[model samples]
Target chain A: MKYINHEELLKMEPQYRVQVINSLSGFKSANLIGTRDENNINNLAIFSSVFHLGASPALVGFISRPDSVDRHTLRNIQQIGQFTINQVNADFWQAAHQTSARYSDGECEFKQTGLTPHFIDNSDAPFVKESQLKYALKLNEIVPIRLNNTLLVIGEITDILCDKAAIKADGYIDIESLNTVMVSGLDSYHTSKRLSRLSYAKPGILPTKISLDGKS
Target chain B: MKYINHEELLKMEPQYRVQVINSLSGFKSANLIGTRDENNINNLAIFSSVFHLGASPALVGFISRPDSVDRHTLRNIQQIGQFTINQVNADFWQAAHQTSARYSDGECEFKQTGLTPHFIDNSDAPFVKESQLKYALKLNEIVPIRLNNTLLVIGEITDILCDKAAIKADGYIDIESLNTVMVSGLDSYHTSKRLSRLSYAKPGILPTKISLDGKS
Candidate 1:
């Protein structure tokens, strides 16, 4: 086993520290955040930090570095009050990954990466047409993490588009069957194989593998 | 494809909405958070909401619903200001998931789930002995998301313990090689297969596959 103390971690090469620290959190969601400015220029950026915040209001949150390449995304979300979170799948993950590249101001990642941007329901933000599972969100809040000057961009899920076959009888979406990929560290992409969906946990009762149809 | 608008989502059965909304975030890290009260009572809980907040200063954040079964974990961290995040692996993911069972107050999840807690370096928190990669952290800040009444508990990495061979030359840990599992929705667990590690993205230049050793 290797043990790295805080001091050693701080002193390691900067890039190395980033990879190590980022990977420490384990696997992350792979999603392309789509947005558009008032000028109607579309923007797309791949984000691995997207997380489920709550379900009652159907909130989603993703970390945004205001000073990073994501500034356009953060800016557009603020300007338009709408954006899309599209899952990065196995088929177009390369193009999805390419969206992270630092594009020039006003440049459209959808155009640069050849991913089609589709609009629906008078929404201001564009959606990646290739994404198998995607959703539209209305900007709800931008809470700053003062420690690092990063913003926690929270949004309310207002709409969703997914393959009907993926939604099970009990509401579990079989994302693995849709080929939605995951990410780790700064660059690695992966696909998953379901191990099991155990039954609702309760004390003194061991959880048994539950099928997607709600059968245990 | 099926479309679910905001109204339809709001009208969903609460449990069904929870499952559907939770799965929309794509895959999530599966982790066992270990904490201990001032009286030395250990607490273990499964958390899939953990996310990477920042790389510099080595920050990690996880959402905690103040009213949920995770109150034990939140209370323990408040009392001790230290906690450990352990990566759930395929070998013991079922045991890890079992930690989420709501035991009565002061009941140690470690004992309830039969998962051993290992302590080191005078730390108040315990590390799961079964975890292949784990790290100790110091509580930095607790930011409340007033929108949902959930708290984002931020912590700084203080120490790390992992298998020596998993750390690649460029510092990206091969977590898949360690068999670390991922979670989706609430109960489903997954193991990953590497697709590819792409090179750093650059505008107008396509990203190519990079090897574990950092060679493209």
Candidate 2:
């Protein structure tokens, strides 16, 4: 493999680089933003850049660049103090895509794209009216990355909203029943489906047997 | 969206939890791990559990259960003081999967899987022989997640090793071209391909332009 420096790495142009990141974050499906009118005026768009930060506080974040001036999503998050991460399902991929358009600062994506906005109960945050899963994050910290203009927006998962019925008794999130959109970088969409559930194990260890068929 | 409790969330098993995490970590794309193995017990494994921790020290980590009864990969890092992270690609997925096998404590996954092992000048941790990108990581604090028996293995990424050709001029890693596999949930896999890349902005903000055309 060829090891390149930052100078050489940054020479690839915006479009090419975005494609690579998009591939990393895109492909699976789509998602939409669920923000309040006041905040939507600040202008927020959702990209597949969104990813799970950790489970302790149930943190999640997405990468965003400046509106055009090239500020950074971390900046807006700092201003907002709180932001809602709404899961995109098949139902809202298109509307979510529309939100991606660089709209004016004062524009309301909900009205323009027709995705309904629902205020969450636990927090004073707006949510995707139809999103089956939503998260209210209290901005924790915005960590910049090694790569050129990228930043990791970390947050404290203050509140989690989900379609409880979709959550399995065993704690499995049954997004498959809801058929939500799974996104990669961009231009791709997927539905939630179960393939095979692997049995748990530690490396080089055998699971204890409760009973050997006929032998106790 | 329905909100569930921590008890209900914890009830979910690790097997299922891992899959959910894989999906969340950009669905398990390959990354490069590079280090020297002074112990001579070359350890190389592809983890969908691997993720970008705080980028400040350029940290990244992957969670692994004990190799055997009480053998822990984390413990190895703690004792050895170093390790490498290798990004997975189509070229090495099959071989990488083999490393996931529960090998005996003394066994080298590189030998057991027949995957080549390579090392760099700086460290003693061996990297996956076929990974296109690799990194040298110094052991950092390990935080045990409050959940069942899982751990948040944290490492500080000190140096990066990559194939310059795979890196784009825009600081983007063209992982799809590198043929990396993305994981969702436990066993599901998604092959990455070029999609769309967009700048970050609030919803309905102007100056929206897609960076990548159809082809990258």
Candidate 3:
């Protein structure tokens, strides 16, 4: 057993956890691809942590490291007050992850990753053309966590672009079919599998299986 | 490609996607167990999501969910203004998950799961006797996340208590020897495996042997 203070906790090595909450939701690979500032033209990165915070108002967020690194994605989101989150399935991971490089602010990751960037009206960000489950979000608020230089960036999901049938009657996104990957401890990625579903689940209750792998 | 509004975006069926955050970085499965509330007299079921939230004033949080059916955990925390979070090792999961059942208030899960409960000073919540890691968190603030009626409960960690030697010089806890289990998805649990220890992992470079899974 061990106990330590805040300073001690900070001393721990940072885990290189990879993948985000995107793409694993099926449809297509390359869930997010966007350009950096207009002048610097930097290339951004791809991740799966993009999550829906709420539905009524439509909000989304992704966690990122603090200012220690000049991340282009956060910069673009801050400067334009908007950015696009593309969808990536099994097909686009190679291209999507390619965006993780630290390109000059003037370089466009969209071009380097070989992804097509298209713009939508009434929005400041561009969308990924290849992603089947794409959307645009306007930066709403940046809630800085007290953690060691980590920020929980929350964004309002302004527009969602996806297949109508891909949605369910109960209002849940079916993402297992897209051959999505999940993030594990520090840089490890794993292909996700649908285990089960529940309107409500408790222990000892025979949990019924409704394979969420998108096969259905 | 499909673009939809709020109603349409939520129309998609929710899928079970689990990713490891490397947050529970202590001796796995250690906690102080204690009963909570007068009405929900049942033993309070708790788990570790222990991660750093802040440092200067000392803030931390654990990710806790409402009891699948009746919301015991949330109610307990809400009613008493305090509850202890206990750890379950690679061995405690069966009993830990068992506590998820809808036991009547006053029903002790400690009794049901065979876990020994130990009380602390001036506190009614008893710490789990068997856990290798345990800590007490005063009610700071609870942020309810609106995700598919699921709440991502965030608690401001006030005071943390652990075994001193559990932490190593590299600034990480040597929790692997404690035989703690990590959760993925819903029911899947795994033990710690040290693939490699990195020297200094920045954006482009990472420590070696973090995990052999791939492209780490």
Best by lDDT: 1
lDDT for model 3, please.
0.48
For each candidate in the order shown, give its overall lDDT on alpha carbons: 0.93, 0.53, 0.48
Please state every model's RMSD to the true fold in angstroms. Answer: 0.8, 7.0, 8.2
Which digits, one per residue and each the tens of the lDDT, describe model 1 over residues A57-150? Answer: 8999999999999999999999999999999999999999999999988789989999999988847899999998999999999999999999
Rank order by DockQ, top first? Answer: 1, 2, 3
> Interface RMSD of every candidate?
0.6, 6.3, 10.0
For model 3, residues B1-216, the per-residue Cα lDDT tens digits are 555654544553343111111110111222323546766464656443334343333344444545443366667666776655555665665566566566765567777678887655645556677766555555666654444344444443323444556433333344444544544323333454432332323234323434232323
DockQ of each candidate's interface versus the true one? 0.89, 0.22, 0.16
Q: Which residue pairs does candidate 1 place in steric collision?
A: none
Which whole-number lDDT from 0 to 100 does residue A114 have in model 2?
78
Candidate with best DockQ: 1
Model 2 DockQ class: incorrect
